[model samples]
Target chain A: MISYLLRRGSRVVRIILFISFCNAVLAEVEIYGEASYENRYFVEEGLFGQDKSHSSFTLSPEFYFESEDQKTSFTFKPKIRRDSVDNERNLFDIQDFSLVKVQDSYETRIGIRRDFWGVTETVHRVDIINQTDQVESFDGEDKLGQPMINLSLEREWGTLDLYVLIGFRERTFAGEKGRLRLPFPIDRNSAQYESSAENLRTDFAIRWSQYYQDLELALSHFSGTSREPEFKAALKNNTNLIIPYYEVIDQTGLEVLYIVGGLAFKLEAISRSGQGDRFSAATAGFEYTQVGILSSSLDLGWLFEFNHDDRYKDSPIALGARLTFNDLYDSQILSGVIRNEETGETNVFVEASRRVRNCCRLSFESVYFNEGTNSNSVQKTFEYLKQDDFARFEFIYYLGN
Target chain B: MRKLFKHFLFVSLFIFLNFTNADDFDRGLEIALATDKNFSGFGDSQTNLKMLLKNRKGFVTERKMKMKLLEVPNDGDKSLIVFDSPRDVRGVAVLSYAHKVGSDEQWLYLPALKRVKRVASKNRTGPFLGSEFSLEDLSFQEIEKYTYKYLRDEDLEGKGCYVIKRIPLDPYSGYTKQIVWIDKTDSVILQIHHYDRKSFHLKTQIFKGYKKYLNKFWRPNEIHMINHQTNKTTTLFFEEMTFNTGLSEKDFTQNSLKRSK
Candidate 1:
């Protein structure tokens, strides 16, 4: 085991050396990223066997290099993180490291990267290129980088991108002591795959996006091993376990947005063919903003979004679908306010300073996982998550030049 | 010879009559529009700036950001600002597309969420990130967004200038009116006094250290804004600037905002 760890460690060092050498060779370098520490303290005590609080420290550094003419560039962002509660959650990752070359009307990028596609705020039904880094956040705000070679062509009509993705990365799950988690701890050793080639399968995707006046639209198609895994109950370490089962699937998605006045309407729909019958899902929402609210300099935005998954309307796999489409609530209405205080413009923010989420929210969120206390259903994951609904106060300080 | 003298006298008299007239409102708009037109037609620009914020208590902090502006013909200009320093704001970018006919569209991209949230462009009176500058102050400063009133012609710092009071057409402005001093020699803003919504003097901004870039573009090397009520001040220095950059409309898009360094 020591020799195995040594080999992996040496590989990491070699890659880091190679990347730094490349950056050194390229002169014009721009370095960026942040060092941040955040703690999330649960309001109440642990449920069953969880901790009352969780804290993490992160150092995410990125470097970018481009030529004088800007035709060729290399971008790299390496993240190192440490978590107090869950040892499995602490790790290192290459969030984005890509080499890109731009030609007339076209650009080609090769390496690990991150890509997003979708318009709705509630759920990202159309964004599936990168796997979810589940331990990072409960909102699915973090993503694992995907290894891909992408060629993009810009035409008068729109921009077209074709991607050949390799090195399939599996979605991670929360550890046992984590707050939001499945009923049983997921056993990575028991993972199963539909394809015999398994993790070696290469994925491919193509997307075309266009914006015209008040309307923006994009259509994408992806075919490969699914980033999402299905869990089946199993016996492991004398405890009930949910063994991850990976499957291959094809997904086509369309995202659209239209803006009129101070409001914007967004829709993201996806149709996939995978385990069980064919299914389709969509998240539709609209954001209405009241500018300069109440004769003050504040802006208030009201967001109303609803998600519909045809698979969830069914009986047998409804609860499973809920677990798969975790953050997507059936109906969610959130209102947020943003105010730029005239006093703390520099370093004088008092209690809650420069909050991007700004003011506050009393959101009404409802989702149905299942109506039963069945041990097979992971409905408890969502039930336990309700305890994490919190009102947080944050203080932000700007560091560095 | 007599006819030429008579013609010149009549023309001089006509100019004198309008010069001292009470119709300063019309002249105010003319001066304002002339100032706007002088800075027009430069395709685009890229600038690096360092900002210093100091409170009344003598505490000082610094910030660095990169700004890119692209001029839109027959309309308001579009700009993109990416904050590079201040690790907390690293990778935060804002894209603003100003229009001549309507409210501008501004989008703020937060790197933590990898999401671009829309900001109400009309929320212009509020300070921008605790700085003395507002959304309108950093915007394209389109002439159509305000109504002008010429106050007087005065000599400021030995240079001829026209002082004007401009009222924003948007009612939500934090100030009822802003008095501006435009230098006549170079058509640049020399000073501006911002009033609160209650029509009281709140802050004053001065532009100094002017440098001509690309021979035709005159940009201020340093700008100091002082808040009278709070005794706070923020100063911005344009560390480096380049005009006529080859930036297209694509660089100002939402995708470009996300990709900003």
Candidate 2:
């Protein structure tokens, strides 16, 4: 069976390469991709009751095509990842596949695409477009492409975007064998949606963004199935089990940022109402940078942010906090620093694993879960991560960036 | 005989009046403004380039990037620079909205994070991509950004050129002053001498091997900048270039930076 699976994987690779070659030869297309290996070492033996060490390799390729006049363009990107310790944790995703046509001040796009809509880094409370590709990383920076018909109009005042999301994709979770995953495997096949149409439910969103001098502001509203799913208890084979439940939700978001001198202040806030009741969340932060320090061409920067959320879930009090599945850790703060070297285009940064480089980069990062919070909801929700405050060392090698 | 005297008087007066008028607007400022005015009207441009960085020991490294620019009327232009080569930074892009006043607005897109980072303009003088070119050097240099003083006129390889000294108005500027040479015939910049804060000659940038595009814009084939203190050099070679691409304000924006290929 293993050999057969390997053969299938190779065949899939060959087919993709063939298609990529044809695209290169047939049209005005440019290819970009990266292959990297990440070796992560958890400080404890089993943070998620799994392994102490984990390693994964990913190969991502993107094909970008444009007309000679650049009036029309398209981009298709696909990624595949394989974990050394768990075949079940291997994953593949069509990160972005979109065709866009630009007409004067308006542009229209149709297909699967990703959109980001927040300013704060510690927590992204307002960026809610595509479902999180959780299996990709813990930071949730990676996202799955969303199917939509999008229209964006640009004016001197601001940019307005309208989206018709045609289909919903369930979020991916790390397999049970993965260390950074939840305690139990999230059964994607048995997922349920509150909408009768389920995954076929149509959704809509609108956003307006503008920038004036040092300030950036964006506001958006989305009515759709919440990307975050709550678990519903059931009896499977006479044993208690839980399946993911997607709730229809309406969310309004706001983001603001200002830059002055070497300092930047940012904010992201979201208010949502749906199956789980109405709640609000916010994250605010500031980043200050010192340039060319000590007469050298090096930049040193510091970042600090506060994250907050009201754990107001209406999934019924009987279900309790363990299965409510709300993102309410009450309040927490994050702090870190970054160092950039201009001589070699190298950046050595700590705090956010958003840190990536060409040759190689090593990082040590830690985030406190703040388990001893005073709120009742916070205490119950963070019970699982009581001992989760631990440091991690990640070393990545760029096979081809 | 009376008609001849009248004609001579008119001719000499015309010469004297023209000379005074020429000196009316600070000779240095006129030349500086002329240099910028002569190169205007490139509505927008798309350029594929290769940057070669050489260390003092003669070892060389290279990076490939594409630049897209849009000219804004009555304001500075907007530019988006996306790196394509060196594998690691393939999808990295930087968008800059240069202005006639104050610092420019810039954002950087990191493919790994799939996010755009707002970059402060305070570090504009830092080296770009580990090369001799500073991010500020790549921006559209407006006449209002500096104070110019006319120096003298000299011949550079049989070409008569006007020399001028300019001090940056922006406090973040790394240089104390820059001596510039502009070709008298075409008003194109020939060379520049950059001075450090301690009054030391730091670097020299020579623009050579020009090619005229559309019979109006004088595009340099190669820009060579050498660092005197470090004995290092960086050269930029334009490979594929197109101008007046009909790209409007839409293509040079914060959203476009993330979508840029």
Candidate 3:
């Protein structure tokens, strides 16, 4: 790992030198980032041997440089985290390190970066480029930087993006001491891969997106190692441990969004092969907002989504609401509930945040899970997390720009 | 002969009143068109903005952002605003495509999530960055968005001004009408009195320290907005305003929003 970091360090040095050379010709550089502290408290004891609480601190710094002509730019962002209880929760990753050149109709970017795709608020079935940084957040909103060469073209029809992804990063998992974990820990070091090239495999993706009137649509296809992994049981240290098995797969995705007045309709669907059998999944939802509700400055938004996965027999529906207080502090709250129709399992989540003074923000989040009353029903891996209900608070302070 | 003379007087008086009203309407629209035309050839502009939001208790909060605008020939202008401070919102950007009629199009880019979300434009009455200025107040102004009537002539800050009353065309607009003061010499806006839906005096905006750019375009260095009802005020200061930086449509796309700093 040290050798690998050294190799990456050398490349960063070269990029800085190039930027310094352009500095003489009017290139500008900006430095900014954030430091955050988090405290988590669990309402229930873990099913396994785990701590009832955890504390973590994170630092993420960003450096950006742009040319005077606005045609060339470079960005570097590195993040580090230290956890008090769970060692596996500790993280060190470069979130973004990329250089881009923009032309009249085309743009090219190279190096590591993060990319997101999808419109629905509940599930992002079409966002397949970056691997999930699960240790950072189980909600799957956080992602590790993907190293790639991206080419984007702007045409009359739409915007076309092509990506050539190099190498693969394994998904992080919780340790035995982690609260939000399966019955057994995942032995990441012994992970299995279907591809002979293993983590060295290269991936390719293409997407074409466009906005027509009030409708926005995108079609994408990906051929690479699947970011989602299947699990197998293996014996480790006199105990059975879960071993993740990566698979090579091809995926085709579709995204649609239609906006009318204060309402938006969204749909994201995907079909994938090489994971057991060819299957499809979809999430369709709508968000309706009422601005200045009740003659007040607060805006209220309602969201509803239905999720279906072919591999899983159970279907789930999600309902959510977002409230924005257009006050001086920019306070907002989002709460949601997802329930399975067949098993009656439910998950509830809430997040509220507001800006503190000038450079700081404070947020509170809580998540709860309830299992079906039927004990004879099929036990899913997520059943282990039923007792992991927790609430967390985070305070973030941003650095100067 | 007396009855016939009285009927003739009535007919002449009606015609004269109709003609004067038509003239007033035409004159108000002509002035609005002239002001829009005067600023048409700027092509593009870029500026840094700093806002000081002061509450009724004299407490203050500051916000900083950068603005870029590209002129569209027949349609409304396109603009991009990127926040720089209140450091928590740094790198957040909003891209907008203003239209002459109907609702405008807006998209918000969240830097941390790398997500570009389409925003509903109907919420134009919401405060911008928690400041006294609403989203509509900062949006591009199009002559078609309002109906105008010539109120009178007035003197503002020692400058000859044309006072006009204009009502918003959007049903969701928070204001019922606005009284505007435009400089007669340069067609620059000097001040405005905004009235709420109840026709109550709501706010007053004063533009100060105007500077001419490219020997043609008039730009304001500072804009002071005072909320009469809430006793809150927001002052916007513009720095290093530049024009004709050669920005094209490509610079305002969703792809560019993610790249903005």
Candidate 4:
């Protein structure tokens, strides 16, 4: 299977090279590559019933090749990552091969990659995602096998930029089945019982930006449906589970005042359909950043989210701050609090990171879950997590160019 | 008889003025070339240079530099310059021809991985060592790179000088035009103003503290360039300069790049 995949990859590379050569005949060609390595540690508590820590290392490499003529250009880029943790490893790959043709007043490009869309910057970024051979589930026991195709279009007229996107996916499941396979039989024929599923999603967004200015305003809406068999089976068990659902996510935001010696600000708001549904959440946030003495910079941000459901209502607030010294060293601190009225459960968390150098960095994080009672304020009992209670460290180094 | 005599005088005066202007232009070009030749002799046969760079924001960084110059006797007045600076750079060399068909050929060696990479001539305008000086700035350009015009006589730093304007013939050049003040007495360039390709004022380079060598060469011990847009400046200081150290062409080849001391 690996050989077959390699053969397919080579064919794609050959096609890219041929196109690059043709383009180079008319203009100059430049190629470059970069590699980076990262080590991360994770510690989680409360949900899984135990406090466990795991360390992992990941290496990522990206290659870019471009050919440009007087009026036209083509660029091809491929990014690959190898991630390993505790004697297990996997690969993550993403490629963007685009041909851009420019005219006097218009430019167009066709490629398989992420699409930047919408006023909220999230309403219309639907793109094809390949899930086959992808490691799924925390235990790495289940694999998601499927390939998805996504289409998107965007245009700018006057001060408004508009975008739309549609995505379709087909899924198949693979794994060793136990004797009491609740969903299906535990045999090869049962594996054959797996069928292809289709999903359709759409998003619309509008953005207004000023010419030669930093301020921009955008609003967007997204709605989608999932008809995968696995989800359908789960819904069959509980009729309350809805499969063909629609969501109306509205977001409006602004980015203001970007200059060398000035401060900048960004604000965003998100509103969804019904409370407690799959995508029913409302959020508002703003960030401020400025550069100061000796080329040092600082940023601060705050966000608040509200969710309304049949059983309870939830409100969450988060605050973050970052300081950068020169371009090499930086430090960040973040804190968040989530409160549910019905369940009386409040989760609070804090995280921070500091860069030691260009090649190394350190991070610290902690979380405290408090169960509050509405009846008593002074005599309220709560549970909390501490530093020795739950935290991790990470370091990164870039190796080659 | 009187009318003919008067006409002859008028014609003679016009011819004299034109001849003098042409002579002034030729003299200016000669002075510029002579000044450049004298400055090129200030460097050692092979030497290393180090500098501390400070940005406008007060960030400081260190850079180590090495330069080697070779003169070709049999290859039609050719010269080679090799430079190695900070940032894993090794074996970066430039081959210049007093008369090449198009432009000079340059190659850079990456010491970290032990590889020699060729640089395209079209990128001559790119910065060298992250400074205002470009690769093209170091190469010897034939008279064709610019069309020199004598502007007028001027006094610079208590020295009699001829002010000349040079307009680039090649569109790819970084500068649209350059104005140079050349000292007539010592045949040395005192100062230069480099304009952008679009004719916008860009930067000024000032040469000072000249040290006479061998009683024949006048070399500037210091050169400074102030960028107008960025409000930043870079200064190059020459130390331990020597001439006639017997640099040969064999020291400039691709094979010699790796073997350099």
Give the number of the best model, judged by TM-score.
3
**Residue B210 shift from truth in candidate 4, angstroms:** 18
Q: Estimate, for each residue in B21-115, the C-alpha lDDT of model 1 and write its tens digit.
A: 65787889889877775568788999998888887888776768999999989888999999765555667898998877766778889876666
How do the predictions measure up, each by TM-score? 0.77, 0.82, 0.92, 0.41
DockQ of 4: 0.02
* Angstrom error at residue A130, model 3: 0.6
lDDT of 4 at B237: 66
Which structure among the candidates has the greatest DockQ? 3
What lDDT is obtained when candidate 2 is compared to the true structure? Answer: 0.74
- Residue B251, candidate 4: C-alpha displacement in angstroms: 45
| Per-residue alpha-carbon lDDT of candidate 3 for residues A1-401, written as tens digits (9 for 90 to 100) | 24433644565456456545644564356777787878889997789868788877777767788888889999888888777778888888999899999987899999999999889988899999999989777578999999999999988899999999998888989888888888889988888899999988999999999987678899999999999999999997898989999999999999999988778999999999999889999999899988778767788999999999998868889999999998889999999999886776888999999999888999999999888675556545358888899999999989664
Q: Which lDDT tens digits does candidate 1 get at residues A100-186?
A: 887766778899998777787646888888988987764586898889998887777888889999967877776777666665777
lDDT of each: 0.71, 0.74, 0.88, 0.45
B174-227: candidate 4 lDDT, tens digit per residue: 788899898887777788899876587877888889888777667677777777
Rank order (by TM-score, best first) = 3, 2, 1, 4
- List candidate 4 stretches off by more than 4 Å: A1-46, A49-51, A70-91, A115-197, A200-214, A221-266, A270-282, A289-312, A327-390, B1-261
Question: Mind giving the per-residue lDDT tens digits that candidate 2 earns over A233-288?
Answer: 76677755567899999999999899988788888888999956698887777877
Task: Evaluate candidate 3 by giving its C-alpha RMSD to the native, one decimal.
Answer: 5.1
Off by over 4 Å in 1: A1-30, A36-48, A53-57, A236-239, A260-262, A288-301, A313-381, A384-401, B1-26, B116-118, B170-176, B195-201, B253-255
lDDT of 3 at B45: 95
Candidates, DockQ: 0.16, 0.21, 0.67, 0.02
Of 2 and 3, which scores higher on lDDT? 3
* Cα lDDT for residue A240, candidate 3: 93
